[model samples]
Target: MLTTVRLSIIVMVLSISGDLFSQIRNNYFSASHPYFNYMGRVDSSQREYVRFDWPGVRVRFRFTGKELKLYFKGGQRNYFDLIVDEKRMGVFYASGDTVVEIEGIKGKGPHSVQFIKRTEGEMGEARFYGAAFYPEGKLLPWIGNSTRRIEFIGNSITCGYGSEALGRDEKFDPRTENVLKSYASIVANAFQADYHVVAHSGLGVVRNYGDNQPVSVNLATMPQRYSRILDMDDSSTWDFSSWCPGAVVINLGTNDFSTKPHPDKAIFQRKYEELILKVRNVYGSVPVFCLVGPMIDEPCFSYVKEMVENFKLVYNDSNVYFIGIPTELLNDKDDLGADWHPSYIGHQKIANFILPVMSNILKWNY
Candidate 1:
């Protein structure tokens, strides 16, 4: 009888241990898992952690579970948008290393999650460690990336600075800056394209916003930063071949022409042309759209249009085109966000204006 009792106890313990092991194995997934689909310029060198700093960077995956938790290590305060099963739950902020838990998920079967960065690179970088699911879950194959891709290069406007501010008089706050609400994002979502934003607030093609000296070479200009994977890290070069865009949009000149001592037209045009050439060198005849303002006008507008026309004539390139967003497109009273930047409504208008043009140019069905 003593021997039989001992045998039964051992069997119970073994069964419990086996169940625990299986639960752990099925519930946890590393960030490097093949099923996690990462978009934008992400550094995946580390097996356990994937890092990205660009605005609009996104990670998507699917799993089967009732509850999900995501782990992240942020170098600085950054905001993100969390979407589960195509519905946006809300915006959340992460700083330092932390775990975000979403409890009481609606369905019991399979569900999808999209985690997107809503701020720009200046907000700092973040590392995604992995995810954990409760009550028996397993990672599913990723939904997959869109075949359509676009790259937008610009300054504050493209970065969606002050996009979510309460009003034009409101001060610039990081919390209010939502790139997901920007025109670039709106346009991308409209066409169902995976897009990249190589944008920095206050940056320009030749001179940055409010710089006193004109024609001074800004080492951190958009052209120089274009090749970097991380906006702040100049040493880290992005592999252009890894992801190429079907269309490229350059929405600069707002910062270059915003302040006094404007850059010489010749110099400005030269730099703009160089930037265009750089795009050509990288992608080989991808449709390039030279965009000018909803904020800037006059010389900046004329300069861009002239430069694009000249570039086409000189290079014999028909793929390059010019599009302008006039100041009249937005209403000053109702359409401004923080610090007089375009609000979500303003961005929507901008997207609507450009959508048809883009569709006509790229032959993409709306």
Candidate 2:
């Protein structure tokens, strides 16, 4: 009789446990759902998936658990970073179909997670399926995102190509690039602001990075695709009405200066001014700053200065400003990212110089 009673007790406990575990399985929310908050060029469609291809784009959501698993698919090999409860855990490389399981989280009641795509569109697209929580956990209510918004528009530097390398000569890999540490990201994070990075590698306003190449065609330039979705498929336009940024940072022209067969000064300046006008039209008097970078040479910096001055004249706009960061800071042996790009340290050097200027402009404390 005691043996039978013991068996019955075990069976009843398991039945109750099974019902509790089922709650976690039933609580998953798709990426297309509103529970997921996206930044940058992530597109949600009726097809039940969210596709993101740009570097520095991010997806964030909340869950109640000590373990979380990310379900995702990518058009090609891709790398993404995870930040749980405001701390960066690590990067995940997803090549085939799989679940990125993050276990043993340090929290108790609830946790916040942000999946950040580190590679640019050159690698291919990444589609987020959804996320799963641990046993008996569920989703949290959505309060709005953190702070003011800033949009960064530029090229390889902004994409943070080769920024994760510790050594100077290490070859570039998609897995070694991290946009989360780029200068754009660093400054935005300092301000506790949401940022959008619209960038592509080896692309510029007038031409791509190549030696003695032909002049770029109409649609080949980065500016042509700036208004598009995921920086691809021109037919799918990015509605500017979707989100408004308090400031827009322009970081182009490095590729144009570094690449051979560059355009004449008059032509480059005209194109730059035209792009600025188009930006103003879309953003409507939003503060625009030309972030002359810690990459290109003095001549390029001169060009950026002239372009910003010229545009401000056209609109008589005081909101337009020039932020010049000398490229010489990266000349030190320890400063190079990889293939001479800015590493996390190099990005920090630039951020330290520029962030203070931005804080002054916005009248911010930090």
Candidate 3:
């Protein structure tokens, strides 16, 4: 009787294990799968993959499982911040193989996660292959984005460089930055609009921050890499044809003028206006708002406004507009992030100022 009981127990255990294995799906999805959310220009990778370099570019997926994992391969060393549900998780460096699975969410759950790249474009880009889920895992469909799309183009400020750090003097680390916490993301989210961020650190419209290397020897600036998917190289071009934003916000020239005795005012104004025209030609009739920063003050600020006025009048373009963040907010040390960048509250302050401006301009309900 004891032997028979033991054999019966073994059979029950085997049955349960079989059921669990049956529910497990080790399937790898195509990189182009709609379940992923991308925030920048992306290009098709070999076979079934997608790659991007714009800081803060990432993917989101939903699954019904107790455990979830991601598969990715990155060049050089790359990092990403994981947000499970809405809670910010730790940052993880990408490994060549599958990452350890995230399990036991509040013990067990059907969880949603957003994987955001925390590094700048100059550092490296991440290529995501797919995700994994266990025990009845299923991928939810892509979150449909019905609102008018908007694109923010600029430098580190737009990239959220050091936006999460505590001190103004704290050296900026890629891990401390979150592009989603930047003013661009804040404004986009406030208006329920999908956004594309094309930004890098220390890059400018016509010059680089503290680097005086001639164009022949220096890295590409914003205008040069404007249409490229990867910021480092021209390996692939962004198919602007695939998606169109109703408006484009440009916040540049900070790096160009970062050094004392800035670039020639006449030349800077000309190049700035030319950049505006280029954006107009690409997006076609989309309102182009020339944005300035809280980092800028006084005479420099006055110069930017003058350039905007000239661009609008010169091109006879009524759609081109100018908006500047309040300089007073820049003095608020508590709202400052690392290396003199804006913190989360600082970003919110800018977003708050522009939320109404965008709403009225875009005809958004918010």
On lDDT, the candidate that comes out on top is 1
Residue 282 Cα positional deviation in candidate 3, in Å, after optimal superposition: 1.8
lDDT of 1: 0.84
TM-score of each: 0.91, 0.88, 0.85
Weakest ten-residue segment in model 2 by summed lDDT: 7-16
Candidates arranged by lDDT, highest first: 1, 2, 3
Q: Candidate 1 lDDT, tens digit per residue, 173-217?
A: 889988888999999999999999989898888888778888646
The alpha-carbon root-mean-square deviation between model 2 and the true structure, to one decimal in Å, is: 7.9
- lDDT, candidate 3, 237-285, per-residue tens: 8878877898899888788776755666776777778787778777888
Off by over 4 Å in 3: 1-25, 34-37, 74-77, 105-111, 213-217
> Residue by residue across 70-105, what tens digits does model 2's lDDT show?
777654757887777777766666554445666667
Task: Give, for candidate 3, the lowest lDDT window spanning 10 residues.
Answer: 7-16
**Model 3 TM-score, all chains together:** 0.85
For candidate 2, the lDDT comes to: 0.75
